[model samples]
Target: MSKVYSTQELIEILAQERRSCMNGQRLNLAASVSGNPVIDRFLKPEGIQKFSAYNDFKAAVHSYQRQHQVSGIIWCELTMKGKTLRYPAIDEQLAALDSDLKILKAAKADLLEFWYTGIQGMDLYLSINFGKDYQKIMPNDVKEVAQKTEWANLYEYKNYNFWEIILQLGWGKPEEASYKRGWPKSGSEYIHAVNPGKCPIC
Candidate 1:
């Protein structure tokens, strides 16, 4: 049997893992090992099991998804140090930008969720699902929003900010979706390796 962890619990676990990493700089949750006490709890065939390495942990996750036929939670770390755009600031700036474009109100696109996980520095988790509305909300729209938004704090790395809204896994077919080394690229890395012919939104 597998234990189900709530989204908040997962976030906390991810935060703890982030803090344990190299000053939260190389915190890749998907590629992380099962050293965290909480990892086994989220795994199926549930009994306290230890994965010796990240490959073991990854294999377990893939196995669980294959057995359940569902897409597992994918955490994409958006920014390591969101000097001006952390949590409420990011929400506020995005809200203001949305007000102008009426993007959310248009009922065409989804920004998904944003989480402000404060580590030794600062990190923000931004999840955007441009599935159905990929036609209406072009990738440029996200860049424009990020460009137009005002930073609450003084930040110098605005040029480094990029939206990971280019491609999404074919969620409808989770069974076939293989776990690549990095499917959803993280931290300002634009997804440039999508198959246009296979990807509906690519």
Candidate 2:
């Protein structure tokens, strides 16, 4: 029988994986805000005019991941037509982006729960679906789990310090879950409250 872990177990597993991959090196909090030049190319004003579709965004992320030899988490914040959007779940967004970019190899979706057990912290659970392709290089089961199990949900704790993507899995449903359970009251509040300081971004 296949091994199935609980949500908390999955979170601990992913967190350990993240720590191992980092080699104990602390991640730069500003890396996401600084943005990748390749990513910035598509996100800039002119680039936005040229590549406005979500597929384009996905392509840029895939390309960036390939070149950097890094994988795990990705975060995006954007404004279009005076409407602003912040993507807290980096893995899910990337999965959707991969589909849009036609790069999705294997796709899967499951409910995931996230919680923060710290003062001035946050605790909420939500569902997240994950997908991946692996460029046709890795083993089947490895790719399957990599695409499906590797991802983290986003939580904005404080201003200008949004927590980047972190890895989590096997999230079960909460008693009082809703479609809009964990979202903040406003964009400003989201930016202020969701910081990496409060959450792990691996």
Taken over the whole model, the C-alpha lDDT of each candidate is 0.30, 0.31
Runs off by more than 4 Å, candidate 2: 1-58, 72-116, 119-150, 157-202
Error of 2 at 67 (Å): 4.9
lDDT of 1 by residue, 94-142 (tens): 1122232232223212222221121222222222342222233334443
Candidate 2, lDDT over the whole model: 0.31
Per-model clash counts, in order, read 0, 13
Write model 2 residue lDDT over 16-105, tens digit each, in one string: 544543452333332232257876765534333332333343454545444443332333453323444443333432222322222212
Clashes of 1: 0
RMSD per model, one decimal: 16.4, 19.4
Maximum-lDDT candidate = 2
Single out the weakest 10-residue window by summed lDDT for candidate 1: 87-96
Candidate 2 root-mean-square deviation in Å: 19.4
TM-score of each: 0.22, 0.21
**Candidate 1 off by > 4 Å:** 1-3, 14-52, 58-202
Using TM-score as the measure, the top candidate is: 1
